[model samples]
Target chain A: MKATVHVTLKPGVLDPQGQTIQRASEAIGFARIADVRQGKFFEVELSDDGDLEAARAELERFARDVLANPVIEDYRVEFLSDLPAASEQE
Target chain B: MKATVHVTLKPGVLDPQGQTIQRASEAIGFARIADVRQGKFFEVELSDDGDLEAARAELERFARDVLANPVIEDYRVEFLSDLPAASEQE
Candidate 1:
């Protein structure tokens, strides 16, 4: 199973990179871009250990402890079984 | 409408950050991680302009020209209509 984690800054946090992108987009003649926020996307490949529930919990902890900095960033993990769509459940 | 762009390095490209994360995971006692790949995720918020098809085309070009390094990276643009599900049909 593959776990995909998206780590994004919480709203109200300043994102300089996103600001640069917003300005860059405008400079490049693209319009209607109200805002842009950048983040980290990670695809973690794990050998199937069968217990998805346990794996999900483990991955969540891993994501929290290692992948994202909980103080300013938030992360969401989605499980993609066998490389197909990782049925993202909110 | 909001367009999401995920820019990922093409296969065969070296990802040192991912390698670091993989090593760190192992050192931290996290197991079953066969591989880990990292990428950039961008959320571009655009004010509605009505033509979804045209917007998609524009966003596609924007992604290709700006967000991705065609030499070594690949990007996919997903349109999220009205902040809900971006009806990612591909």
Candidate 2:
């Protein structure tokens, strides 16, 4: 099974890389863009032994402890097969 | 309006950061994990004047030209409000 973790800067946190991208976008003529926040995404492939509940829990723990910095970022985990349609959730 | 860009390394690209994370996961006792690939996610906020089609096209261009390194990475752009549910797509 596969899982994806999204780690994003907490709202109000300063992000220099995001700022750089925002500026670059403006420079490239995308003046309508207002802001940009950058984050990390991790795709993990795990050996699925059919215990999905346990796998989901482990993946969430991995996301919280290993993939995200709590002081500045927030993260969410989703099983690849469980991901919703592209028009429902962020 | 808000959009997200996910930039990931192409398959077969050497990812030292991913290796480090995989090793760290093993050290933390997640032995079932087989591999991990790390990527970047960007959340962009734009001034929406009700033209979503043009906005999406511009966002895609920004993702391709500014947010991703095409030589080594692949990227996808999704409008936050248009993102699918957690189980439909990855």
Candidate No. with top lDDT: 2
lDDT of each: 0.83, 0.85
Question: lDDT by residue for model 1 over A1-90, one digit each (tens)?
Answer: 777999999989999999998898888888866688999999998767766666777788888999999999999998876422223332
Best by DockQ: 1
Task: Write out fnat for all predictions, comma-separated.
Answer: 0.86, 0.88
- lDDT string, candidate 2, B17-57, tens digits: 99999998899899777789999999999887766666777
Candidate 2, superposed: residue stretches over 4 Å from native: A82-90, B82-90
- Model 2 vs truth, CA RMSD: 6.4
Candidate 2 true-interface contact recovery: 0.88
Cα TM-score per model? 0.86, 0.85
Q: How well is candidate 1 docked (DockQ)?
A: 0.74
Off by over 4 Å in 1: A82-90, B82-90
